[model samples]
Target: MGSGPTAVEIISHLNSSWQKVRGYQTETEVAEYRNGKLQITKSFLYSFRKPRDFRIDMHHPHRGTSLICCDAEGKILVRPGGIGAVFKKRLSPDNRLLADPSGQRIDQTDLGLLIRNIGHSLTDQRRGDMKVTDEGGRLVVESVASDHFLPGVLTRYRFVIEKGTWLPAQVVELTPEGVLKRVVTFGTVNLLSDFPPGFFISDREDRGGGGR
Candidate 1:
């Protein structure tokens, strides 16, 4: 209830924490809704390194499927699940096959992009109507905007940040009428200075069951 960190201050904290991260691995769960109904939920073991290296191991729905991109400009390598795991395919970054249920591309799902988007939304606002509160033991930052803060979506963003790490534990997006649009929850984050050799290499020879 007392005065908490402002939106700018929270953004600064997120930026500072992100700057120290050379790479990271985390479990991410995304729930998307439509017309006030929960449509789908997807889970993944998400891994990322600086300068656009990423690997996504789908844990729910598409179980054994894995997607990896070692270079920013190169195509995404996809290893499908089930019997399709025996084969591998490469597709462009904008390929529909590489998009999530919500149409978000794999290249756009990193924490760095999330933080940058939040900063952009806040900066575009003429009036700062952000509020920071103590929810349970976590810090909740909520902000509303007259126009759509994120692309064509006009929703209120609620960011629940973890205590010690200063990283987001969960992010909730709600429509102007208070309908839940999406919820992204981040599991325990493991920050690393570097990943082992060939960690992001998807074409490496392997038994290819699920993820590494």
Candidate 2:
């Protein structure tokens, strides 16, 4: 398949396919690339590292709560926070651990991202004409990449899929000001068939981390 893929075609190709990924009990290794360039490699345990935290919100005349996690070590990442978890980590795929101890759940729902969903990674594409640029408008940047993704505003973002992989190396969320609001870079991942039983959880040996 040549002739450059379209957005809809990309989604169709992705939805019709499923890749082999690892589970909680297994270790995973992932690799990151940028514009067909090698970036970084990381490994960790998914079950434990994937979950950051959980929350329950009982307010208004509605029942609501959410759980959050991040198994998207190497997959789609759309809209700052509007997508599902991606391909699970695959054990023995790469020579690295899959569980991550340093990761935080951040939210209540474990709704993480997938490899294909990374394409929807924009701020507000649904804002109709609200996401328009005024006369003589340009872009700004915090780093060399240029662009600051802002919060609660109409903006545009572009994600480039790496060739031969489902990973999106460079993600730039543009702000209403035309600057980058958020930029996420994917590093290499490690895949393992098995990991230590306790590697996924924090040891309760001392609940207090030398603090109250």
Candidate 3:
């Protein structure tokens, strides 16, 4: 399918949809180039709420650690998995410990920011043309960026947006030379008006410790 929508048009629709979301939870899978081969590097259960409440529960690699950021404190409360769960640390948003291998901060991983970045790339004339096409029954927005729109890489981008919700279901980043760089998939998205009480409050915070 071709001649779907202009980049500007798609971004507008996505922003409208995103503004209606009060909260959401999703299972996320991140894959990236490692040792010159694309490998699934991390999997996590992510939860987010409006006004800056979010959580990340690592399921692979770390396997036990969880991070929670609540608007109350504006700091990341880390509860390590395994035996380390007994201890917790409250770190600044830019703390290296809160960063991924690609140096993406936890606070920057929200869907709103992702769409905004894509809008920036598409609106910049130097990034070349932006195209929206129907791929596998989804609207995929494709564009190329001359500069590193993402934190660490410059690449071509394909954002597969769920037609029903206008939210990104998957994002594929490729090297300018057309090699796969990274792909992040969002699955089982559940939208809610609000989480139950104490959802964003970690055990440490609940106990009044608030980490160190």
Candidate 4:
């Protein structure tokens, strides 16, 4: 459950993983192009083994999108259904975002910060004096209270990195009450040769004949 790996060590592992991923693959629905990019959109689903499911309308600009979800898996079900919504997005800046649309807020940063979090968690996990659980998992950084997700609660994190690519394939978030707050798993990475020309419309007016 515990390892000698320091925060630095975990960070290194995560960073190394990111480097392996040249980019993400996106799925599409009648894919189109505008402004020299591909616009792929679809309804997506993410599920965890413990019965957690997340839904999203994915709009992938380039790196593709994942319908991400998670929960305790393979029976021995501790929790299910997961918590909240997850929307994956990436930009030319190389930033990937998992956003909460209703929350009206998002972390502009993306994949790299996630790796740093893994490092931070690994460091904390190695602390000799922390509470130990026979069921192993990483700690969620900075918890708070309230209906948004409950107050003063701890959420444990678990994950799986893709082989060869090193991108995150799965992730989990569990509350102190053993309730699953979030779960996300990715699938079907599609490498496209070219995106549609109308893919990146600047404004409503630019939607052309497609405007509703």
Task: Identify the leading candidate in terms of TM-score.
Answer: 3
Question: How are the candidates ranked when ordered by TM-score, highest leading?
Answer: 3, 1, 4, 2
Looking at candidate 4, the ten consecutive residues that score lowest on lDDT are: 71-80
Order the candidate numbers by lDDT, best to worst.
Answer: 3, 1, 4, 2
* Candidate 1 lDDT tens digits, 1-212: 23797667878988999898888999999999997789999999999998789898999978989888874456677888999877777777777665555556768878888777677555575234777788766898777653333355566777788868887788887866777888999999899788878889754564232321
- What is residue 6's positional error in candidate 2, in angstroms? 2.2
Expressed as tens digits, the lDDT of each residue in 9-84 for candidate 2 is 5444444432333322222333444443445544432232333321222222122211112222321111111232
lDDT of every predicted structure (CA atoms)? 0.76, 0.31, 0.78, 0.35
After superposition on all CA atoms, what RMSD does each candidate show versus the true structure? Answer: 4.1, 16.3, 2.7, 15.6
Candidate 4 — what's its lDDT? 0.35
The candidate that achieves the highest lDDT relative to the unseen native structure: 3
Clashing pairs in 3: 64-81
Candidate 3, 114-138: lDDT as tens digits: 8777777677733666777887657
Choose 1 or 3, whichever is better by TM-score.
3
Q: Give the distance in Å from residue 15's predicted Cα in candidate 4 to where it truly belongs.
A: 1.1
Q: Which consecutive 10 residues in model 1 have the weakest lDDT in total?
A: 203-212
Candidate 4 RMSD computed on C-alpha atoms after optimal superposition onto the true structure: 15.6
**Runs in model 3 lying further than 4 Å from the true structure:** 71-73, 146-153, 203-212
Residue-pair clashes per candidate? 0, 58, 1, 21
